[model samples]
Target: MSPLVHSGPRAPLRWAACTCSRDPAFVVDPAVQLVFKHQGGYATLERVEDGGTSAHEKNEPRFRPYDGRVHGVLYRVTREDFEKLAKREGGYVVQELQVQTYDDSQYNALVFVSNPLFKLPQEVIPTEKYLARVREGARDNYLDPAYQAFLSGINTVPGAGLGSEYYNTPSKYMGYSFLVIAALITLAFFFQH
Candidate 1:
């Protein structure tokens, strides 16, 4: 009889955001890190600035200009993990909040754990191949070769090197060229006299 092998299903995690009011006004800056833990491991949290409008809708009772919300980054984790993290310290109950006027605002929150409805592909092509394809596509689309060359030159320039300093420091070469020109001019003047 052949031995049986089983692989457990992957967990589903939805990126979410939460907003709460602080009695003492707090300065929320962009790029703050948030962390969440699960049975398997902990996932890093990402904070995105809530734009001009508040997270809640204007008509909603919870809506407040002073209130702030932290946006989460996209990731995949299990529902059980999410619940466990939510119940632990620093976990806030996911709730739906609305914001008016901002059409691109994300409102829905994860109220309960559920099965992952989507799965992302696992295999990724090598970086070199991917970039080569981008370059090929640009060539196919009739991108300007001169512009591409200019970008390549800019990217190729090293910040610091013997050759780079020799080329970049025009003052050194300019002074030498000026001296040669002055000597040639002086010789011509003497011959003319």
Candidate 2:
């Protein structure tokens, strides 16, 4: 069976947006020798606000070559589901890595990592809402207790959920453009009356 490793928000069945089977094949360890670095912030696609576009930076799970290991849940997926997953995870690069389950069993699974070219210069703290999803996934999957604690301890930018005050604010020029368009429409309406 083909397998996929989910170490982040997608670890929880609830947060998993993929159409794969709801149940995990098994929880596994050594998903990779790579260190789990949750700090890397990447720019999501541009969000439009007030007729202007702004790209929001958000923290996402990524792995790097380090001395530690990443533990995660392994899921059995069909070829169609795997293709859908690959499409959904367009921002990430996929690699096949070996993972071991609790019974010391091993399977080759596909793991996703943020593309290095898209990584931000400095780390951005994840939002509380985002962290909650990650926490829920780890808890739901019964990941390593120490790893769960470490995940819990990571600080978040309070109230930084999407479209919150922390996200893209319309530029002054966009604001002005909106006002000008409104005024123009109002003038046109009056002239037609």
Candidate 3:
């Protein structure tokens, strides 16, 4: 039987703004910097901000001295769109997208940032094509019962649970303690003799 699909109203996009630094001295790096920019832009485009300050506000023309730091943006996107983008461009790794919501709202805006490993492309692939490929791949490889059983086996081996068995066993010091107690008893017996 096909997996149960939960159908519900689409979620709104949410967004936030943040600043990133790339200098070695700075904790934030180029990858993080791009994420801030992307997320900020995405949020602005969605217009999810109604009563709160946004990363776009800080980047406005009037707000001068925009060092692109100490500012970041966040927002949300449709699950379908997120999945499509993730498959097409190695998902969020190629373009890290951060999203958050303020209270409860109709739509959400997400922050888009460029990953240090990959620069944001001027032209983005459409979400449809990416999702199609992902679906195709899943059908081809992940649906096999054999493959699923193999994966389950790998995941359920003993001693693999919660790390190694040694973690639960007593330490060598405990053995030494028993030995010391035995030695003390022997000495007492000799004195009684």
The lDDT for every candidate, in the order shown, is 0.30, 0.50, 0.29
TM-score computed on alpha carbons, candidate 2? 0.52
Ranking by TM-score: 2, 3, 1
Task: List model 2 lDDT by residue over 1-193, tens digit each.
Answer: 1122343555433224556543332323322222222223322212124543222123243222222245566777677666766776644677666667656767877777655444333345567666676677777777767666766676666644433222222343466788999999999999999
Residue 83, model 2: Cα distance from true site in angstroms: 0.6
Residue 106, model 3, lDDT? 23
The digit string of per-residue lDDT tens for model 3 on 37-108 reads 221111111222355444324432222222322222121345665555455432134332333222222222
Q: Specify the highest-lDDT model's number.
A: 2
- After superposition, which runs of candidate 3 have C-alpha atoms over 4 Å from their true positions? 1-64, 67-75, 90-112, 119-193
Q: Over all chains combined, what TM-score does candidate 3 have? A: 0.19
lDDT of prediction 2: 0.50
In the predicted model 2, the residue pairs found to clash are none
Expressed as tens digits, the lDDT of each residue in 1-193 for candidate 1 is 0001001132122222212211111113433322111111111223335654221222122211222322222222466755654664232234332222122433333432111111111111113332343344334433345423422221111223323212223344566899999999999999999
Please give the lDDT score at residue 98 for candidate 1. Answer: 28
- The count of residue-pair clashes in candidate 2 stands at 0
Local error of candidate 2 at residue 89 (angstroms): 1.2
